[model samples]
Target: MKEKMLSFHDVKHIYHTVRGEVTATENLTFTVEKGEFVALIGPSGCGKSTLLSLAAGLLTPSEGEVSRRGSIGYMLQRDELFPWRTIEKNIRLPLEVQHRLDSESLERARTLAEKYGLGEFLQSYPSQLSGGMRQRAALIRTLAFDPDVLLLDEPFSALDYQTRLLVTQDVAKIIRSEGKTALLVTHDISEAISLASRVVVLTKRPARVAAEHELCFDGENDPLRRRENKQFSEWFELLWKELNA
Candidate 1:
C-alpha cells in the first residue's frame, strides 16, 4: 500500500455569515495514500469543494485536523491562465514564484510541455489557445511546481461534453504517467469512477462520509475503457442511489 499523504481527522469546517455560523463539513475523516487517485462525489452543495479547500491548506478546519505532508497543486474549475503570459511563461510561473526556477527546471518544464503536446504552442498566449489547450496549460502550470498532491476541483466542467471527455482522458493519463497523488472534487459519477482508484461519497450540506468504494478493474486505467467496462454502469447507478438517497 502507498504511504499516507493527506489525512482528515474528524474534520469540521464552518463558515461565518451574517445569519450566523454555517457548517460546511462535519465529522469528515479519511486518508489518501501517496500517489493514490481519490475522488469526492456527492449532491450539489455537499461541501466537496470545502473538503478540497481544507486538503489544499487554503482553509483551516474549525474542528479536527486536515493535514498534508507534501506540497499541493490546485486546479480550479476555471483554467485561470494569465492572458499576458505565454504557455511557457505560465508553466514556469509556479517555479518562478517558488524561486525554484533554473536552467535545469526550465528544461524539464519544456520537456513536459513537449511530451504533453504543448510544445508547438509554447510561445502562444492563453487567448491563442482553445479551451482544451488552455486547460492543458493550466495543468502544466500545476505540474511545473512538482507538487506531490494535486487538488482538482471540477477541472473539466467548463468544456462541452466531447471536450470534457477528451480532456478527462488526457488529464488522467498525465496524472498517472507523472505518478502524482490526486484528490478530485467532481459531481460526475462516471468521471469519479473512471479516474479514481477510490471514491469517497459525502452527504449533503454539513457533509459527512456517506460511502467509499475501492475500484478494481482488469485493464489499463483509461477512462474510455473504464466506461466500457461491464461494472461501470453498475457502480454509477449505485453511487447515484447513494447521492439521491
Candidate 2:
C-alpha cells in the first residue's frame, strides 16, 4: 500500500470573529498518498485557504482531525520574499530559521536554485526578477527545507496569464522530479486538471467533498503536455460541470 503523506479526517473548522462563529468545513475527509499531487478545488469562499492553513497547522480543526506523516512546506499565493534579501538569501531563510543552516544544507539550497535555472540570479533581489522568477525562488526556498510534503495555495495566481502558464509548468516539474507529495488549493479548473494526480472538488460554504477523481493521462505528467492531451478538454469539461453543479 502507498504511504499516506497527509490526511483530513471528518474535519470541521469554525472561525470565531467579532461578528459571529463561522463554520468553514464540515466532515471533510481525504488522504494524499506519498509522492502524489492532489488538488483541492471549490467555489469562491468555500474555505479552501482555511484548509491549507489547517494542513500547515496554522489553524486547528474544531472537530475531527488533520494528520501528516512528516514535515510540510507551504508556498503562499505571493512569493512573500523580503525585498532586502537576495534570491540565495531568501532560499536559505527557512534553513536559517529552523537552525538547520550548515555547509551541506547551504550547498543543497544553491544546487536547487542552480538546477531550477536561478543560479545566475542567486544574488538578485526579488525586485530584480520578474514575478515568475520570484515565485520560483519561493518554491526553491520551500524545497530547501526538505519538507516531506508541500502545501501550495495558489502559488502562481499572482502572475500574468503567460507567466502563470510557464511557472506552473516549471513548478510541476520541480515537484515531480523531487518526488514530493503535495496538496494544491486552486480555484482554476484547468490548473487543477493539469497539475494534479488526483483532484478533490468541494461544495460551496461549510465545505465537504463533492467529488474526487484520479486523473489519467497515459503516463504523461508534465503540466504543458497534460494540457495538450485529448483528455484535457474532457477533464476540463467534467470538472467544470462539477464546479458549477
Q: Per-residue lDDT of 138-185 in model 2, one digit per residue for the tens?
A: 999999989999999989888999999999999999999999999999
Over the full model, what C-alpha lDDT does candidate 2 score relative to the true structure?
0.95
Residue lDDT tens for model 1, 1-245 = 76889999999899999989889988989999987899999899887888888898889899999879889999999899989999999999999999988898888899999999999999999999999999998999999878999999999999999989999999999999999999999999999999999999989989988999999786559999999998999999999999998
lDDT at 59 for candidate 1? 94
Which segments of model 1 are wrong by more than 4 Å?
none
- Per-residue lDDT, model 1, residue 26, is 87
Please report the TM-score between candidate 2 and the true structure. Answer: 0.98
Q: How many backbone clashes can be found in candidate 1?
A: 0
TM-score of every model? 0.98, 0.98
* Highest-lDDT candidate: 2
